[model samples]
Target: MGRKNDIASAVIMLGVALFLAGCPKQALEPVGAGGPQPQAQPQQESPAMTPEQPAMQMEPYGGASGQGAVRLDQARQDFQDADIMFEYDSFSLTAEAKKVLAEKARFLNAHPGMKVLIEGHCDERGTAEYNLALGERRAKAAQEYLVFLGVNAQRLSTISYGEEKPLDPEANEAAWAKNRRAHFVITEG
Candidate 1:
């Protein structure tokens, strides 16, 4: 307990020193613990056209009604519930995977405060080492694509579960097809 206090104190001191030394306030926002706090930006005038590009709609949030929070909760759930599936033994993104990823990128862009964890999984056919490596490749591929789509690289992370956890546990092509996927998890928002 005493050691933990000393470490915490040292960290606080370092933070203070950095602040005094002119680090940007926004860059120091805490990660994981309390999630990303929403920034308050001044409202700007809007002129709209183009049916192809939909304008961002504002929703009532906080205060007396909790609808906004509920909507956000649902959106987060949907984001993770939607998985990016890969073909057997392949880390390459399919057309369907690209479409899903594009929608995910749009969601992430809207919610800049979110931090996502991309989990790479595999079917049981491969050896453990091979599966792990393949899983890593799949996760990195998704991360790279997301980064290319304008998500902050710092806001995303990746881990390989390999063949350990499968969405469908039965030994068959259908189950294996389900298992070969890159799953999304919201670590913080």
Candidate 2:
């Protein structure tokens, strides 16, 4: 029984080591070896500090003052300038859509204060309910791609306008292609 327990313990230790090895290089390193870790920082002010003096201050999204706010507003405008389109009856993003999403992610990352609402729209082909669900999937796909590109998840939201909100109400292929898109709306900046 003792020998069996020893083997089990060794196996567990080996598994743990293998799991850690698969983790990112930064995760495996000791904190502070490269730079200060956020978790290691003291949450409270130093005891030597007096109420008369201000503690270390962190700047807002872009900068310290209204400059940041103005930049964020500009980023929001830039975000709205592009729309990511999807194929008919499909939620998958094309190469063009990915390029647009990459740009959107950059802007969203730069303006952390900016909040986006991704509205998914479909053409007037499928049933309203089916189109709504498809639209939701399309919006979620865009949201996931943006998050992957380093945009903060908290700043993004999604909604499905479905076939109800076609950019072109015409029943042609070109109009349908144009309508099947994920539209970006700046909810907050």
Backbone clashes for every candidate come to 0, 0
Global lDDT of each candidate: 0.74, 0.70
Candidate 1 residue spans exceeding 4 A from truth: 1-56, 60-63
Residues 1-189 of candidate 2 have per-residue lDDT tens digits of 999999999977655443323221212132223332223323323332334222221222212233433443454566796889998899999999999999888766644556899999999998999999999999999999999998888888999998999999899999998999999998765
Against the true structure, what is each candidate's TM-score?
0.70, 0.61
- What TM-score does model 1 achieve against the real structure? 0.70
* Candidate 1 local lDDT, residue 160: 98
Question: Per-residue lDDT of 60-80 in model 1, one digit per residue for the tens?
Answer: 231224344555666777899
Where's the lowest-lDDT run of ten residues in candidate 1?
41-50
Best by TM-score: 1
